[model samples]
Target: MSRHIAGDMQRYNVRPNCISPFAWSRMVGAIPTDTPEQQARVEKLKKLGTKQIAPLASDAAADVTAQIFAVHGNEIFLMGQSRPIRGMHTSAGWTLETIAGRVLPAMKQNLYPLESSNIVFS
Candidate 1:
């Protein structure tokens, strides 16, 4: 969405970017901490304040557009764009068995972990 908006608004000199902020706020304070892992995550989140997000949203970011900036505490990350990392081709095409045996293994290393956002990012 940010990319699309940035592209469309480029003619007007509008730069649109997205900010995915992980800060300790009222909404985050309400997260359930029933589990040990959840409690640990909450503890980590407590260190990141809402003020940390202000810098990225300010005029300092005027030069960038069509980008996702993940702001956690004082850290800023330029998130990856949508692009293919790996591909495989077969002249004879593929059957289920061949895909399972060949393609899955070939792509397994590049596949993202099956974990929640907090677990993966934290």
Candidate 2:
């Protein structure tokens, strides 16, 4: 989306960029909890949320327009960068059986966190 916008608006001298913001909001109230322990954990999380502040619209817009600002490109401020952690290679080539038996096991130890989970929110 940011790239598309940047390309489309380039002719007009509009520098469209993207920023992944870490913010705290009333959305925390929507977390569902059943038991007292669960409710307490939710409350704790909600309290922690207060430390994260959302970007101000006027400030963010101005900073992005300035180009001298840090988040001028597709930048993430509070988060870390994506890096390749592990991989597996085979000189003899691989079949489904080999992938399931050999490569999978070899790569399993270096798999990304939550690689086994099926929880894909996107």
Best by TM-score: 1
Q: Please write out the lDDT profile of model 1 over residues 5-98, one tens digit for every residue.
A: 8889988878777788788878888989999999998898888887867766677767778888788877788888877899999999999999
Checking candidate 1 for backbone clashes, the offending pairs are none
lDDT of model 2, residue 88: 74
Q: Could you tell me which residue pairs clash in candidate 2?
A: none
Model 2, which residues run further than 4 Å from truth? 1-32, 47-53, 56-77, 89-98, 112-122
lDDT of each: 0.83, 0.49
In candidate 1, which residue ranges exceed 4 Å CA deviation? 83-113
lDDT score at residue 107, model 2, on the 0-100 scale: 82
lDDT of 2 by residue, 1-122 (tens): 33556567767767644343323246656656788866865655443432223352345454343222222123334324345677678898989999999878878888667641113211
Estimated TM-score for each candidate: 0.64, 0.39
Q: Look at candidate 2 and tell me the lDDT of residue 96.
A: 100
**CA displacement after TM-score superposition, residue 94 of candidate 2 (Å):** 7.3
